[model samples]
Target: MILTFCNQKGGVGKSTTLYHLARAAVASGRRVLVVDADPQGNTTEALTVDVPSDAAGVADALSDASTDTLRDVLVEGVWDGLTVAPTVGEALNAVRDEIANSHRPGWESRLRRQLEGLKDEYDLVLIDSGPALDTLSTNAFTASDGVLIVTQSTKWSLDGLALLLRTVDEVRRYYNPTLEVAGIVLNQHEALTSGGKHYAGELEAAASENSLRLLTPYIPKRAPIKDAVDFSRGLDEGDYKARPLGKLYSALLEQIMEGTGR
Candidate 1:
């Protein structure tokens, strides 16, 4: 299945969630491909080791003037069962601008076309999108089978959730009819804090209002989770403190698989 882990708000741990989820998928022996559609390249940096600065990437695949296909930019991931279509600095941003200003037709479907021939190569494709509902995000939405919305349990994040859902509705209506909301993941939650609890309740109400599923066991604010991504290691590969978080991601992945019929 092709899933885009998206949120229009930055610092919500979107990339980190996708990175760990990809690791969990790899640990389960599934072949996974991570498409780093974000201009920031956080996912690419997490998944690859010692990549060259000028490596061809998703921007090359999406660029009208470039001959590189998605396959051409795929690099070996840290895990054996994983691969990545990485993005370098400023390239994706430039492509986004080009796409936004272009007079060409079907600008939104460029990433979808790029993924068509490559979908069968991996069991799962996870796209880490930029923190905006702009042209690049439109391409990600157009290309994806479903979207996994990631957000923090905070007032600002909750406010952004409404706009994000509206954008998803628009994408579904115009670009990809079969696209669905895989689920909403509440990342970096502080379960004991009053503020976290209050916002989480609001989030639940928002999900219910929109008929969306709020994934269980909200990801906590933990040092180990951050460390795992920073060290370029899977949570399961980390010390005892990180193993439980790996299990949480594994459960979330299972829920996603079941929802998407994978």
Candidate 2:
């Protein structure tokens, strides 16, 4: 299954969540592939330290029609069972205007066709998307089997969700008809405060009204999570099960797998 972590608004932990969840999935003896679809290359940089300037990444794959050639750009053994098709810099973004303004039919499904050739090698594939409804993000939606919406529990984020859901619906009708909403995951949750609780109530109501499943064990703001990113290490490195973020991520992984059947 291809699960894309997406939210048009940034700083909602799409990269961070993919990083932790990829680690958790690998620990469970699953062969996982991470597609860094974002132009910012946060997930690529975090995993590969520095993407080489001349390296062939997702840009080469998307720019060509040769379906089976994407594997040439795959970076293997990044972290045990995880392999990455990294997107660095703005090479892929350079074609955004042409893609948006052109009258080409079926250009939107390029990434999906390319990924379809590679889905059998891994048990799961996760994509980290940029904070925009651009060509790259639309390609990710076209390729993905399901989308996992990541957002903070706030009024502004609720508005963002509505906009993103509209885009998702468009992709479903025009691009990938089998696309499903895996779930909504609340990040940086702090339910102790009154504002947090109020937003939590709002999220619960929104999910119910929309007939969407809200995944449990919301991720909290924690130091270890930041440290893991800073030090470029997995959260489950050393006695991490004792850490709050570690336990929360494990539960979140379980919730995701259960909901998505991956």
Candidate 3:
């Protein structure tokens, strides 16, 4: 299962979702691969166990198309079951040159094709996308079997979702027909303030009104989320268990696996 956590909008917790799921999946005795397609490298920084240069990272992987090749230098996880294809800061800029001269319509499909050759070695593959609707994300959609979109419950976010869903539909029709929008996750949910409950309620009402069937599981802001990130502890670690965000992520993971069979 290649699940891409995506949203063109930044600060919607794409990297957080990817890392949590990947970390949890590994703890559950699954061989997981993480493809960090973002230029920010937040996922890489959070998960890095070793230092690998950008020149020797993605460019080489795309150039060789070899599954067995040692592409990403940072390799971690229990028994080496978690593999990471983290983007170096250098690869992001260089890819522009490569993509410009490339001839394919969806030049982004390179990552997809690469993962196709490597799918059997792992039980799940998670991709963290950048904050744009560029060719990279198009390629991510092409390579992925499903997408898990994270968004806060807000009017502007609700509006932006229409465009995202349209893009997902187009990608399905043209590139990967089996690609599914497995779930829409509500992040930063809290019922403390009237405004909070109102906004979340409005979102839930809109989803039902539109027959969207958005996932019931949700995530909330918690101190440990920041603490975990700052301390470099993956969600599978016990450091996060006492926080609300930890339980929320655990429920979200269960909901995703049940909904998408991840």
Candidate 4:
């Protein structure tokens, strides 16, 4: 199964969620490949600590000048069963701009083309896209079997979800007809706060209106989740406080797998 975790809004925990999800999948004994398509490289940095600055990555695979394939850029991840195709530096920004400016037909399908034949090598491929609906994100949507929308319980986040859904529809109509939105993931949710409660209600209404499933046991706002990522440790291998949060991610992964029939 291939899934992309994305949102048009930054700081919505897309990278963080994808990181933990990869870790949880690894713990479940599944071979996981994490494709760090985001130019910011947060997922790359977190999953492959101390990756060489000059390493070939997703940017190289997408560039017209390079002969690199996605398979050629694979790097070992922090965990045993996790592999990564990293976005190491500013190269991805250049590639994104190149794709945007080029008149080449099928520019949006470059990543999809690069990802061909990878399904047999890994049980799951999870892509972490940048916080935009640009060519990079379109490529991600084009390549993915499903997209897992990540958002926080906030007014602005809810507003961005509408635009994201529209983009999904456009991609489905044009690129990958089998593409589906696996579900919505509510991250960094502060359940006890009034603002959280208000937006949570709004998010639920929006999901219902769109016939989208909101994955249960929304991730709560917690220091340990961030700490685990920051420290380059899997939630299950971090401080004891982080183990419970790891279980939540495990449950969320199960929900995603069941929803997508993986």
Candidate 5:
């Protein structure tokens, strides 16, 4: 299954969800390939060892066979059946320009083509998209079998969900018609305060109060979540502290294994 974690806004746990989910899927014994579609390279750095000088991850992977291919570099190992088609810093803005030039409507199919080439090689392919509805997000969504839309429980964030739903709807109708809106997950939920608890409660309450299907048992705000990995830190120590993130993601994975039940 190809699952894209997307949102059109930043600071809403898009990368975090991708990181934890992909790692959790790996820990769970699934061969997963991660596509880091964002230019920020957050997912790429988190997963990879060191960076090259040029850092044209997507360009090297897609446009040329001689350049260091993302598939060859990342997919060389079978870690718990997980692989990655990672992105490096400064990926082709050319993709944006090319999409603009092509009057054809298959821009979203690019990732699909790449994945089809590697389909027989893995069990699941996960695409971690940027927090915007750009060409990258389009590729991730169109290439995916379903999407896991993440949002912090806030009025503004909730408002943005409408636009995401619309975009996925278009992908379903036109691009990848089989793309399913798997479910919505509420992240960083906190029941400690009235405001925090209220937002969390509203999402939990949404199912009974409306037609919307909300994923059960939302992910709460854990302190380690916002902390970036200290690359200089000892590898073993870093692994120990990051356990909470893994556990949280494993729980989310378990819940996702359960359907909407509508």
Candidate 6:
């Protein structure tokens, strides 16, 4: 399955969620490929070490019309069973420009077609998109089988989700007709507080209104998650896997696996 972790608003944990999902997938004995379509390259940075300065990556593949295969840009073994097609921060803007200006036959569906060629090699493909509705983000939606919408338990987050869902609807209508929204992942959750409860209720209403499942076991605001991102380390390592947050992610992984049947 090709899944894109997306949200228009930043700090909604899109990159973090993708990173964890990749780790979880690897732990579950799946071969995973991650596409870092986000210009921020947070996913690329977190999962890999010593990214070569001269490597031709996802941005290069998207921006260059001559690029034919994803394997030319793939970085092998970023983790045990994880491979990455990384982005160089500034190069994605060029990809956006190419997609906008190129009057080509398959510009929008380029990523999808490329991944289709390698479908047999990976059990799951995860795309981490930028926190905006840009060309690269559109490419991600077009390329994905399903989308995992990440949001916080807040009103502003709901507004972003509305915009993102509209984009998803357009993509389904005009691009990938079978594109499914897997569910909404409420991240950095703090449901015990008064404001948290209020926003949680709001999220529940929004999900029901949109006919999206509110994915179970919301991820709480925790220090280890922050530290894992900050330290560029993984939480499923060593004793951390036994922590509450790790167990939470394990459950999240199980839910995702059940959805995808992986």
Write model 4 residue lDDT over 1-262, tens digit each, in one string: 9999999999999999998999999999999999999999999988986789999999999999899999999999998999999998799999999999997999999998888878678999999999989999999999999999999999989888888999999999999999999999999999999999999999999999999999988999999999998988888897678899999999999999998888
Expressed as tens digits, the lDDT of each residue in 1-262 for candidate 6 is 9999999899888899888777778877899999988988788788887887666788777766556377788886456898998876577777788888987877788788778878689998999999989888889999988999999887788777778899999999999999999888999988888877899899999889988888989998877887776666557763544356766777887897688666
Pairs of residues clashing in candidate 5? 31-81, 31-82, 32-82, 32-83
Candidate 5: where is the Cα deviation over 4 Å? Answer: 60-81, 204-213, 228-245, 258-262
TM-score: model 5 vs. ground truth: 0.83
Better of 1 and 5 by lDDT: 1
Steric overlap count per candidate: 0, 0, 0, 0, 4, 0
Per-residue lDDT tens digits of candidate 1, residues 73-183?
999999899999999878999999999999789999999999999999899999999999999999999999999999988988888887898899999999999999999
Q: What does candidate 6 score on TM?
A: 0.94
lDDT of 5 by residue, 24-79 (tens): 66777777787877767777767665556464566455442335545564632223
Stretches of candidate 6 above 4 Å error? 65-68, 238-242
Pairs that clash in candidate 6: none
lDDT of 2 by residue, 1-262 (tens): 8999999999888898888888888878889899988888888887775568777788778774424356878886357898899877786676555567666887898788788789999988999889999898898999998999998877777778888989999999998899999999999877787877899899899889989999988887667786787666777784444255676778888888888776
Better of 2 and 5 by TM-score: 2
lDDT of 3 by residue, 1-262 (tens): 8888888888877787777767667766788888877878788777775555633554456542334333443366322468877677666645645665777675767777677667888898888888777777887889998988877766556667778878889999998899988788887666686766777888787667755657766677665665676566754464535444565666767777887765
How well does model 6 score by local distance difference test?
A: 0.83
The lDDT values for all models are: 0.93, 0.83, 0.71, 0.93, 0.68, 0.83
Q: In candidate 1, how many Å is residue 55 off?
A: 1.1
State residue 90's C-alpha deviation in candidate 4, in Å. 0.4
Report the Cα RMSD per candidate: 0.7, 2.0, 3.0, 0.8, 3.8, 1.7
Per-prediction TM-score to the true structure, in the order listed: 0.99, 0.93, 0.86, 0.98, 0.83, 0.94
lDDT of 3: 0.71
